[model samples]
Target: MSETNDTGTAAPAPVSNWNVPNALTTLRIVMVPFYGWALLVDGGDSVAWRCVAWFIFGVAMITDKVDGDIARKRNLITNFGKIADPIADKAITGMAFIGLAIIIDTWWMWAITVVVLVREWTVTLLRLSILKRVVVPAAQSGKVKTAAQAVGLGLLTLPLLEVDGWLDVPGEVVYGFALVILGIAVVLTITSGYEFFREVWRQRHEIREKSPERRK
Candidate 1:
């Protein structure tokens, strides 16, 4: 379909440019399981597997940026992207966190994973329920929450690196820092989810008040 700009000029067809972004988004989704397998299910403390997993995580993160940039620049924004993008993101990061928790054998990591997953799933349902009536654009807090999650997960995975005794600080110290960052990400995630729900609720209420049934 063609879109019109504010000045009434006709816009070009978007179909030609939409597929590339969709393909890249699909690649990101495919990376999630490899990340989980390498980090959580791998046996032994092989430095090579750790390096491979970290490399995959970095590449997957880059794809997130590349897909979004391509979508905006090419105007390849599709309804598919609106749903798939978030699903891809949550699956990758959520599995990464849970995998890390399993590898590290820590209750706090599992707790954080649960919190993050809950927020993601809740907002996802809220968006799907309201999509026909109103668009729920990504918020700044939500973006910040994603950044924090990526950084925290990257740090948590750092323990797999087999740096020599030449390195200064202990791995425990580094893990502690990851925990702190994860905590902060959880807070932001919860806050952003709450804000999104508030907006959805407001829109629902407005629509209900304007309905024919409510006029009675």
Candidate 2:
């Protein structure tokens, strides 16, 4: 049975929150603190602890992908998913970047992390401000940025040299590779931020032109 308005027009149905995708999103948010604990529990020095942290990070990232796929495939998308999903992604990855910066104790890492965080939060706020009027779905560049961040963080989370030298690779070599990936991530972050702002500006202009006051 559908409810009708006073004019006898059918009312729109409410978006459901109790869905698989939403549950996954909530789980991802819940895991952020545990992920942080795993990363920082041993000052990021212990090989075992670092491994645990990497595993947790990996799982969280997987959930990010899974939830999105499920939402799209099952037609379970909702306003809450749209807002909460990105926040979950940022929180987990942001925690990783911060933990890595602190653990590595390097000026460059800290600087990169700060720049990325600032861009992420700024764009997030911009999106939220116009969320009701516009739905800015994730772009390809944004996905690349996320992938680069996850790979870089995963590599950095490992205790490379401390692990058994069965692979016979130097720690410096592995670290350098991670740094390169993170640098790419940083570039993509900036570029995508610019794209988001450009879109937001266009949207605002469209809204203004369509306004009844503007017509008069």
Candidate 3:
């Protein structure tokens, strides 16, 4: 936004980046290391510690949603928020994928983690790289992907496989359900990432095609 000066030229007014949404984003970023620590404590085997990790993760994920909502509703969006928000998101989720894979110690789990993490990080980095060059709005499948990842990973953060005897079956059942959701999230992740990249390419190509300098 700008205001006219005495000479009738517009003078830009600087908006402060310090705001509630940014505060939440910062809090989320700060929580990542602690969340990772909690998840890895006792090799992610202790039921109590795992519960603690889940609580932290749940709080972090909630803040992720709340901060974005606050930013959009209050018009508190900032360059800092744009950068920190995605980093926080990937850090937390990445830790979950990596930590869980380590704890599970299965080739299949590791494969899933590797595939998802690669896609997540690649998409996140490309998004930030093109932050100014293009406005790539999130599609419906992308939104669903985010929600599925959150819920699936949050469920898996619990000590699902550690409970013994009477609770073992129930835990495995829940873990299976979480796995199903995670599988869906993985599919959505790949598809949405492709869509995002395709859209970016199309927009860039369009811009180049319309350039009069290029035509001449």
Best by lDDT: 3
Go through the candidates in order and give the clash count of each. Answer: 0, 0, 0
lDDT value for candidate 2? 0.87
Model 3's C-alpha root-mean-square deviation from the true structure amounts to: 2.4
Candidate 2 per-residue lDDT over residues 5-95, each given as its tens digit:
8999998777699999999999999988988888887687787888888888888889999999999897899999988988998899899
Candidate 2: give the clashing pairs: none
Candidate 1 residue lDDT tens string, 1-216: 569989899877656434887888888899988887777535525556666777788888888989999888977898888788878887888878777767766777678778878889878866766468966688999999889888888877665245557453576577678778888889999999988888878887898999999999
Better of 1 and 2 by lDDT: 2
Which ten-residue region of model 1 has the weakest summed lDDT? 159-168
Instruction: Specify the highest-TM-score model's number.
Output: 3
**Candidate 2 stretches greater than 4 Å from native:** 2-15, 164-170
Question: Candidate 3 at residue 204, lDDT?
Answer: 88
TM-scores for every candidate against the unseen true structure:
0.85, 0.88, 0.92
lDDT of 3 by residue, 1-216 (tens): 578899999876654688988898889888888888888888888898899999999999999999999898977888898888999999989989998898888998899889888988888898888556778898999999999999999999999998999999999999999999999998999999889889989988888898999899
